[model samples]
Target chain A: MLLEIKNLQASVEGKQILHGINLTINEGEIHAIMGPNGSGKSTLSQVLAGRDTYEVNAGEVNFLGKDLLDMEPEERACAGLFMAFQYPVEIPGVNSTYFLKAAYNEMRKSRGLPEVDAMDFLTLVKEKMKIMELDQSLLNRAVNQGFSGGEKKKNEIFQMAVLEPKLAILDETDSGLDIDALKNVSEGVNKLKSKENGFLLITHYQRLLDYIVPDFVHVLYKGKIVRSGTKELALELEERGYDWIIQEASEKSVVA
Target chain B: MMSTTLPTESKEMHPYTERFNQLEASEWALDPSWLNQLRRAGIAHFAEKGIPSIREEEYRFTNLKPIENQTFDFCCGAPVADPGVSQVQGFCFDQLDAYRVVLVNGQFSKDLSDLSGLPEGCIVESLNEAVRNREDLVQGRLGTQVKVDQSSLAALNTAFFGDGLFIHVKKNLILEKPIQIIQLTANGDEGSNPVASHPRLLAIAESGASFSLVERCVGDRDTAYWVNSVSEFFVAPNASVEHLKVQEESLQAYHTAAIQAYLEQDARFTSHSMAVGAGISRNDIHSILDGKNSEAVLNGLYLGQKNQLVDHHTLMDHKQPNCNSHEYYHGILTDDSRGVFNGKIYVHQIAQKTDAIQNSRNLVLSDRATVNSKPQLEIFADDVRCTHGATIGQLDEDSVFYLRARGINEARARRMLIHAFASDVVDRIPYQAVKDYLENILADRFDPKD
Candidate 1:
């Protein structure tokens, strides 16, 4: 197994969000998690990404034989963990290239290697931009400032290319994209996927799963996973909706 | 105004008050008629306004008792020589080609100054000569541009100003080199209260003219003194002016300055005020847009260390249509120091289509360090856009740890982040020498253990 979570529980501000979650993933696998609003999909990603606001009640996450929960957000990035945010932050007056250089340098420092300078970093970023089909001028402008929704999503993919993480988490990356943008974003993600890396794609709609097809599908109702199956399960759920799973989970708790 | 009314300190009634009051203006009666009236009016206004109280809306952050307690005698004899030009000197400009004016103790020094590179039609003289020879230029513009009633310090400056620089650039003229003014305050005898001096500066740029002015103040490192300075800047239509004021006085000194500016149609004014020294310092800066299509950019940085107290108060008034203004200020405080920043931008009903933005950021290095900031915007015009923000916080711990985990020591990491925090304001300054000097000073002041 490449990524494993056992009895994962978490809370934010004295309110429980995630309860007793269990999942496992292998190399080169794409896992899609579908849930309704406030069903704790974003919270799971944030907790796994090591954001300081969430408190883990009971959980153990082992990634590539290391304790992933014991690191900072930036440290998690350097340790081959990436999270594409739902709402990206804009750092005004900070050049996009400068921010990327600093983030990349931090990653390199964690791996015990010398960092790249300005000239070399620019040369490298230009090649990565071509892969994402992003405008070159975006590197000189402020980070995530005045950028369209699609452009911001593509920039997140470009950052993933620069950092080269082992586990990439996509949190609602398709919410704001048009058809053309969705296709381009999918192309970028397809090019980045390899046997050495795995993906945890979280979305509310099954429409995004059409382009980035997942090998495993899980239904998250309320907090815990109610059902798990192959890709065909997503098509069935799209045809039938989530009323059956939520009803079944409610009945199971009553019987217990 | 005296609600708290603590018993007055004995130092407030020092002996020099009687002597200063006795030496009336015998020399003013021999001067021009208009100048005498202006002086008398200024004195009358000062008497009415008295001193500023801490409860006043405009001066809520700046106290004036320290300024009113000291007595400033009029140094009216022949110009004093530049004292210790070689000691405590800054970046030597010996090889640079420019016009330089030196002032010692609020008096213009002729023997130790040089003004050889300016154009033919430009005028650079002392305040006395400017009033005597160019009465039209001096009387037509001085004190008419600023709102003196809003600030008691400006009123006092108008009343007590003795000697300073008078610069005028003719129409359609472009100065190839900058004009530098050096104001120096030297140490006096022991056991005496810190002497006070008031220096005045007036600069007028004609239509289609452009120039730069650098005003710097320095003094002995361990002496106690007070420097009250007032400068007026007037930019005519289609003109541009860049003004830079640097205050690096001794730790035992008290410094205060008030800068008033007026901009006409299609005029541009860019100014930066950097204060890095003095035991107690206060700066009052104001700019007014009096014509259409005018723009102003104001930036400032104040670094306070130890037990020092520094206050910066600014006001930008939009009185006409189609005008824009931008202000950015940042402060770094360490130890038990205190820093205050109060910026206000007002848009009148007639000032339509106005756009203004103001922001102040503070970096507190210690638990005991404190900063008080208030960024306000009052707009009466319905068709205008205005926004203001004030942020008070310390360095991001994650960013610091990220840098430290990258082989940078904790000290160097803090320094790098502080420099990054201040770089936005520093990059807006136009002069290279002034920017470099300020960057060096900030780096030294923000060191981890400083």
Candidate 2:
């Protein structure tokens, strides 16, 4: 198994968000967590990325047989964890090419490998940029500064292609992208997927699931997984919408 | 308002008062009668008000007691201690295609300066030579642009200054190559007594003249020498001047310099002042947009660490209609250092349609490091577009986390952000060599062994 969360609970500013969320994913498995807005989908991604704003209250998250909550964001990243932010941060005066090269070399250094020189790194980054269909000029401009919503999402996927993380968690990567950008992003993800790695897609709609079929689709509500099934479950929910799932979960809680 | 009034206890004898008496009696080179009267007026003002005290409104944040308590030996046309040609290159005046002028201890060095192939009617000589030879050009323009009683330091410079740069571009002439002046101070040979140098530079560009000039103030460490220099520029109608000033004085030195320009109709001037050295340095970079359709751009980048204190005061005076001014100053303070920026955009009543933008951004690294930034906009005209803001903040943690999420470590991420914060001002420079030189310094400072 690549990752296992046993009764994980978290909160921010004295308000609980993710309450006892238990999940597991084996190697080469793609897990999709679909939910309504403010249903703690992004919170789970942020908490997994080691954002300290959410206080992890209890339980354990074991990634690659090591405690994930004990690691810093950089340590988790060096251990092959990457999270594509829903809203990419704009770092002015820092060019995209330099930022990606630095990140690429940093990952290499963490694995006890020699850092790639400028000539080699440029070749790798250009290849990755082509996979995402991002313009070559974007590499020279400031990172995510003055970038459109679609461009920001594409840049995040492009970075994931360069870093080649073990377990990639993409949060709302398809929220603002058009159909063309959505297909391009999905294709990039498909090209990077391997038997040795896993994927966790945190999104609201099942439209993204139609492009990249998930082995197991889980519906998260009130900070807990209310339903889990195969790709057919996603088709059923897309046709029926999330109202039925929320009603079923509430009635079951009332009966209990 | 800038207060020119002396404090109540002004009758006390001051160091400059006694030093002026000694220097005036000594034999020195004389210029025209106007310059003589100007010097006398300057000495008279200096004798009355020796040094600005901390009690004053302007000097409240800056204390000049360390500079005022002791007397600095004003080398009256004395030969300065000479250094080898290699020593000159050590100050980072390396390979650049330009006309070179060198001054040691504020005294002009003819052998060190090269002015060959200068265009006809273009006078690029030392002020010591220009005052006597081209008196017609140097007489009225020298003390006319910058007042003699602007400050006590200016007064002292006017009273005791020896030699400086004097450049005059002919009408409608455009020079492709820049004129670089490197002022080197290595006068520590005068033991016990700290030597002082008051160098004055005067540049006048006739109508439609265009040129680029670079000024560097460099010196060795471990000296308490003072550099009280004044630079005045006069840009006539339809002329343009680009000026770059780099101050890298010793850590134990006191550097007080000013660069004031007068812009005329359709004239344009830009000044980029980068201060990375000096124990206690203060600079006054003021520009008067005096004519219609004139423009001025003043930008600065200052990095200070340890106990160093760097202060800058600027004024963008829009005097006529349709003038424009743009300014950006960013400072990065580390350790227990302090930074101060007081920029004023003064628009006169008749200066209609003035478009001015000023922004001062500072990054104080340590809790002990502080910055006093204020943008004072005094607008009298109703039809003007003036946008002014000042920001003093530390490195953003969100930016750091974003980089760290990409697998970069905490230290390296912070370094990248700090470099980004500092480079925004330096990157705006138009010269590649200057930008590279400055970026290299910032890289070595923030990220060593990279």
Candidate 3:
């Protein structure tokens, strides 16, 4: 198994966001978590990524046979976990090319591999930029500064492609992208997919799953995974909306 | 101004006054008699009013009790051989191809200074040496900008200041190479009993004369000393001047300096002052735009850490009409250090159509770090435009997390964000060599392990 979360409960600033959430993912499997607004989808992803704001009151996450919750955010990244933030931060005056190279070198150093110099790093980044169709000039500008919504999303996926993590949790990566940008972003993600790694995508719409199909789909309602199914579950939710699942989950909670 | 009467022979004098009288009577007495009279009056003025206390509104945030309590061996323009010329050579910006003047222990070093290839109409030499030929010009502009009633420290410097640069640029000539003034403050001659030096610079740029002035204040380690330095610039009509000062004194020393510039009609002046060292430092940057249609830009940055106290007080006097002034200062404080920034923009009633803007921003990294940022604007002109803002904040948590999410550790992530904040002001530097030197210092400071 790539990742296993058992009874995960977390909160932010004393407000409970995640309540006993349980999920599992194996190698090569792409998991799409579908949910309504305020269903703790993003919070779960943040807790797994070791963001300290979402305090884990009770939880245990096992990744690659090691306790994932015991690691720092950078340690998790070094351990092959990646998260594409919902709102990419704009770091003015920090050159994008230098930032990416530093991150890439850090990942390499953590794996006991030789670091790539500037020339070699540029060559590798140029090939990946083609996958996202990003302009070379963006490399010279500050990180995420003055970038359009579509460009920011594409940049996130471009970073995901560069770091090449074992388990990539993409939080709302398709929210702000237009149709063409969404296609390009998904294409970039699809090109990086393989049998050795896994993916956990958190999104509100089913349009993103059409480009990159998921092996299994789950419905999250009120901080808990109330329902679980295969790929058909996503199409069903897309057609009927989330009212049925939310209504069912509330009724089940009352019975318990 | 207070009464300029000299004290009678029966009355006692301040120690600084005694030092001045002793130097004037000893073998170290300067050559010029008129200069001696000026020094005598300056020390008397300082003796009447000692170091500014906390009771003064202008000095409420800073205290000089430590400086008042310690006595230092004064460097009286005498060249020493303890520290070789190689020290000054190694301290300079070698990659910078410019005319350089090196002042060690408040005395000009002839061997290390190079003023060759200067324009025929230009005059650049040590202040003591320049007085022999151009005494009238130097005497005219020396005490014109900063009056004794304005700053007591500057007056005290006028009393003890021995040797510095005196540059008089003729009209319509531009010096391609910047004139680098390197002030290296060494320790006391007898072990480490603490030493003090007062250095000064007088620059006159005539109409249509454009040039760059670079001042680097550095010091040696393993001793405690005090450096009281001052520089005055007289910019004529239609001239341009840019002054860049990087003060990197030792951490165990006390550094206080004043920079005064007088801009005439249609003239342009810009100052970039960066203070990164000194245990207790105060900088007074005062620029007076006395001429109509003149422009002045005052930009400063100070980085402090480890229980240091850095204070900067800036004043922009827009006296005439149709003038524009902009001031931006940023301070980054960590550990138990404290930073104080007080900036004022004063627009007189006659100064109509004046445009002034001032901003003071500070970043405090540690819980113990403190910053007091204040902006004051006094505009009597009804048709003027003035904007001032002050902000004191910490590192943005989201920005830190964004970097950490990309596999960079927490320490390195914070360092990167801090660098980003500092580069906003550093990037404005036009000289690449100076910028590179500052960046290297910043990198070593924030990321020593790298």
Candidate 3 C-alpha lDDT tens digits along B267-370: 99999989998998999988899999999998888999997899999999999999999988989998999999999899999999999999888999889999
Task: State candidate 2's TM-score.
Answer: 0.94
State each candidate's clash count.
0, 0, 0
Task: Summarize candidate 2's per-residue lDDT along A59-104 as a digit string, tens digits.
Answer: 8999999999999898899899999999999999899999998888
TM per candidate comes to: 0.83, 0.94, 0.94
User: Which ten residues in a row are the worst by lDDT in model 3 chain B?
Assistant: B1-10
C-alpha root-mean-square deviation, candidate 1: 5.5
As for candidate 3, its clashing pairs are none
For all the predictions, what are the DockQ values? 0.10, 0.81, 0.77
Docking class of 3: medium
True contacts kept of 3: 0.77
> Which residue runs of candidate 3 sit more than 4 Å off their true CA positions?
B1-11, B23-37, B78-82, B191-193, B448-450
TM-score, B chain alone, candidates in order: 0.90, 0.94, 0.94
- Summed over model 1, clashes come to 0
Number of the top-ranking candidate, with DockQ as the measure: 2
